[model samples]
Structures are given as C-alpha cells and as structure tokens.
Target: MFDVSEVTVIAVDVFGTTVDWRSGVIDGVAAIAGHHETEFDCPALVDAWRERYLPAVGQINRGERAWANLDAVHREALDECLEVFGVAGKFGAEARERMVRAWYALPPWPDAAAGLAELRRDFVVVALSNGGFAQLTHVVKGAGLGFDAILSAENVGAYKPDRRAYVNAAKLLDAEPRTILMVAAHTWDIHGARDAGFRTTFVERPGEKGPDRPADAAETTDCDLSAVSFADLAGQLRGARKGVDAGH
Candidate 1:
C-alpha cells in the first residue's frame, strides 16, 4: 500500500468532491427559470454552463485574461449560456444575479460530512478549493461541513492548478507540500497538486457530470491512491495508521 506517514494535512477539493454541484446548480437554475414562468431545460442549461467553466479558467491559467472571482466568471458564463439556450432576453440583471448566488448553497454528498469527520479524527482537514472565500464559507455553513481551515484561490490571488495557489496554501498551512495530501475527484486537480509537489489521492465521483456525461477519469498511473468514496478513504488511512503502529 502507498504510505500515508508523511501526510499531515488533507486538502480537499470542494465542488464536485465534497458537494453535489451538478444537482445544486440545476435546482438553482430551475428555481429562477420557473419563477419567471418560462419553460426551458434547466438541466441542459446547467450542463452548458459547466462546460464553459474550464475554458474560462483556462484563460486565466494561460494568462490570457485578468484574474476574476468565480462569481464573476460564472456570471460571464451564465450570460453566454443564456444566449446559447435562447433565453438571454428572458433573464435580466436581477434574475442572473440570483442564479449566480445559487453556487454558494450547494448540498454535500452523502459521504462528505461523515467522511470528513472520520478524516479529522487523524489529520488536519482543510477546504482547499477554487471558490472565493465568501463562497466557500457559505458552502461550508450551508452544507454543515467540517473543515479545520479554508484555503481559497482568492487568498493567493490565483485559481487552482496555478503555481501561486498551491504554493501559498502550503505556506499558509505551515506544512511542506510533501506533507499535504491533495484529495480531489477530478484528475486535472490531482495532476495540478502533484505538479506542485503535493501527494495526491483520486476519489471517484461518477455522478459529478450528471447522467449523460461521464465523469473525468484519472490519468494512467497518476494518483498515489484511488478511492471510491470518502468513507473508503478514511478506512484506507486508518489501515495505514494501524500498519505503521504494528510495524513499530
């Protein structure tokens, strides 16, 4: 088994890893659209909105655009998505603003709260995400999540996978990159953390993309550990601790 002896802090990716973002976004969009008494496919619109995320973030990563918070990014994408969905004329500034706020109140996955509690029994678990500080705080409060600390991209003035974000987070935690375990449901996130010198864990979240689109797959031989859920991750870490104690 891979060793966990060096892992002192667990940095978890928030959106897809800890919360059901797809469902949350859909519900939020549906609420706004339904309130307008307009009929449209909220799910399809949500998926389109999500597809725009990586490209927008990619622009920041490539230095093609200035730094913007997730709310702003979501707003820009929402506008584009509305045009594409042929509902651009329907949603005004107020309606669009409410839809953007929906991102802050996502519900946690079934294993999230409990698994986080289990991990906290042995390690410092922090919310390390691309979300803004306020957004992350609201999500933690709304979902009743337990995080010893929060390390947001906003804190470092850069988004995830960015060299600045990970570097600053490790500094803030007073932990070496090697001592921090970056756990994420997305392979791209794992690869980013690994490139930044953090050990990585790939947690499968097949439902992240919803029913039609498949979730991201881990790059071959990329992750240090693979788990089906947060509970399984806790169990593996527990086993590692037991094995270490027995060996001594």
Candidate 2:
C-alpha cells in the first residue's frame, strides 16, 4: 500500500499478465498439428516452448548472446521444441511461420481489456514488454486492449528483469520512475522495476503457466501492492485517489 495516489502511469507486462499466452501456444500448436492430421502432445509442447522463454531472453539480457526480438527467440525455441518432440519434419517452413505468428493474436485474459480501460480512465496505461514493437502492436490490437503507449525492450536493446529496460521505457514516457507503477505477474519483473526506482504492483494470474504449472502466486512480496487481477488493480488505483481530482 505505497502511495498509489502519486502514480500517474502504469507500465504493464503484456504476455502472461494481460494475455493468456499458454493457451495461445497450445491452441496454435494444436491447430497446426491437426491440419497435418498428426496427433501431438500440444500442451506438453507448449510447456516446453514456454520453459525455453527465460533462457532465451536471459541470454540477451545478460549479453551472452546477440540481441534478438521475441519473435526470433520464439522461432528458435519452436524449432528446438519441434525437434525434441520428434515432429520437426511434420511442420514445414510455412506451418512453422504460422505457429509463430499465432502469438500475435493471443486471447486477452477475462479481466484484461475492460480492466485496462478502467485504469486508463484514471492513469496512463502502457504496455512495457520484452516483445518487439511490431509484435506488441499486433498482440495488443488483436486482443482489443487499449494502451496509451506500447514500449518494447527491443527498442532499448534490453529485456525485462533487466533494470535498463525499465529505465529506458520510463524515459520514453517522459516519466520519473516514482510516478510510474510497474504492474506485472512475475516477481522478477517487479524486482527489476523496483531496482529502477519505480513503485510496483503484482497482478495475479493463477493460470498463466497452466493448471499443472503453479504460477508465481506468493501472497506477499516486496511490491507496493498485490492484486488478484487487472480489474482488482484498477479498483485499488481508483480507491487510492480518495476523491482528489476524482475518477470520472
């Protein structure tokens, strides 16, 4: 319960926080595999694909590998997963491309679009993610979520969980870190923003990693606030106003 009243801009992590990426990956893989009339363990494939995300991004974040946007990283992961799953030959180049593009149209979480709209009524809500600009633009638009700005770490050459990414995105908004509230489902992300001098809120996404894979649902952390969902976060932000220049 830090002073949410002072916050004017919200930097949101889009992938798992705003969109159900797990389902998207599963559905995307299933669709392609079915088209080939090939039975595959789509969910397992999705889990494997997602598990590679951290390492892929971590490589760039640590400068161990050359910088590549999320799309390129995802393509790399997809190729590896297909090979490991023994289905690499089943998916040709065109099919692989479509599977990767499917990421751009992930369905928003039930609370996402409306909740973000509510928050926007009182504060600037921006999508700040490790995704590339074009990828984020397509994802946000496809999900029908309205963001005041879409800031990508690719533009800054630094990814999230890296302090530089948060700092650089803050500059683009012409905002001081103190005036911005970083909203994310991942504690690592919150830590990054905190290190960059911003207040943070944890928005819970219990199913983000799917049913069997437990989410990062710590009841409390070092974050300024914790919310059950974006709608809950919006309500908390409104309550913090306390009638000063009250929300409409």
Candidate 2 Cα outliers beyond 4 Å, as residue runs = 243-248
> Which candidate leads the pack in TM-score?
1
Please report, in order, the local distance difference test score of every candidate based on alpha carbons: 0.90, 0.88
Write model 2 residue lDDT over 1-248, tens digit each, in one string: 56677788999999999999989878887888899998878999888988999888989888899989888998999999999989998889899989888888899999999999989998999999988899899999889999999999876998888889988988888889999999999988998899999999999999998888789864755788899988898887777777554543
The lowest-lDDT stretch of 10 consecutive residues in candidate 1 is 212-221
Model 1 spans with C-alpha error above 4 angstroms: 218-221
Residue pairs with backbone atoms closer than 3 Å in model 1 (clashes): none
Error of 1 at 24 (Å): 0.6
lDDT of 1 by residue, 1-248 (tens): 65688889999999999999989989998999999988888999999898888888889878899999999999999999899889999989999999999999998999999999999999999999999899999999999999999998889778877777888989999999999999999877898899999998899888999998989766553988888888899899899989988998
* Model 1 C-alpha lDDT versus the unseen true structure: 0.90
Shift of residue 235 alpha carbon in model 1, Å: 0.9
For candidate 2, the per-residue lDDT at 150 reads 92
